[model samples]
Target: MNTTDIIGTIGVSLILIAYFLNIFSLIKKDGNLFYILNIFGGAIACFSSYLIRFWPFVILEGTWAVISVVALLKSIKKPQD
Candidate 1:
């Protein structure tokens, strides 16, 4: 495998590990920011794997990241009792 592929693989792996850890309670899910950032970073790294050749992942990650960030921001701003 090429260096780019290796690097991308590592990045994706790390993100997935982090994601699952959070979900399983091994890591703290303290706030929306963490979720948003991890997903956003994962999506970016996954999309980059396509290396400007195919663009499916680009759209998938882009939409997911945007939605995640928006939802996170909304949650943070909502009034609390």
Candidate 2:
């Protein structure tokens, strides 16, 4: 596989691990850093797919990444539960 493929694979793997970590509380739900990292990593992975010229992945990841970051930001501005 090419370098792009490897990089994208690593990025995707990180996103999945982060997602499951968040889901299982392996990372604390209230941790801002964790959330930011998750969003950032996911965005990077998704965006990389776009950079590689994959239209469908670009759309899927683009939408999800934006939504994740926006929601996280909004949550930050509001008081915690």
Candidate 3:
């Protein structure tokens, strides 16, 4: 449809895919791919939320994106099991 819709859809799709994969044991939560999906998904979702002037979702997705980034860094620094 619109640019906003397209972006939001992609973001949400990534998040959902990650969740689905995790639930089915296809991917580990601590894996880089998981964090990557969340980082991009949350960031894109946050941007779309901001575009729509939705403060709640913007805050939520922004926090999610930031936490994902931190988690990714920590995961990288630490040894993987």
Candidate 4:
């Protein structure tokens, strides 16, 4: 596989890892690691989509990345107990 494919695979892997961990109760959905993985993975995936000029995935992953960033920011700003 080429570099873009490798990057997309890694990106998708990271996203799936986060989801799997969440489903198995290995990590909290609101945890920093979860959002971090999502943001990075989505960004990488979005970039890969852009490289291939795939508009559908570009929109999907771009929205995912943006939402993840917003969640991360909100989490950081939230008052801890």
- Between candidates 1 and 3, the one scoring higher on lDDT is 3
**TM-score: the better of candidates 2 and 4:** 4
- Superposed model 2: Cα runs more than 4 Å off: 28-31
Local lDDT at 55 for model 3: 96
- When 2 and 3 are scored with TM-score, the better candidate is 3
What stretches of model 1 exceed 4 Å from their correct place? 1-3, 26-30, 46-50
| TM-scores of all candidate predictions against the true structure | 0.60, 0.74, 0.94, 0.96
Kindly list the per-residue Cα lDDT of model 3 for residues 10-59, writing each as its tens digit.
99899999999999999998899999999999999999999999999999
Q: Over the stretch 1-81, how does candidate 1's per-residue lDDT look in tens digits?
A: 877677567656656766787888876664564665556565666567567555676666556567667767777897866
Model 1 Cα shift for residue 67 (angstroms): 1.3
TM-score of 2: 0.74
lDDT of 1 at 69: 72
Spell out the clash pairs found in candidate 2: none
Better of 1 and 4 by lDDT: 4
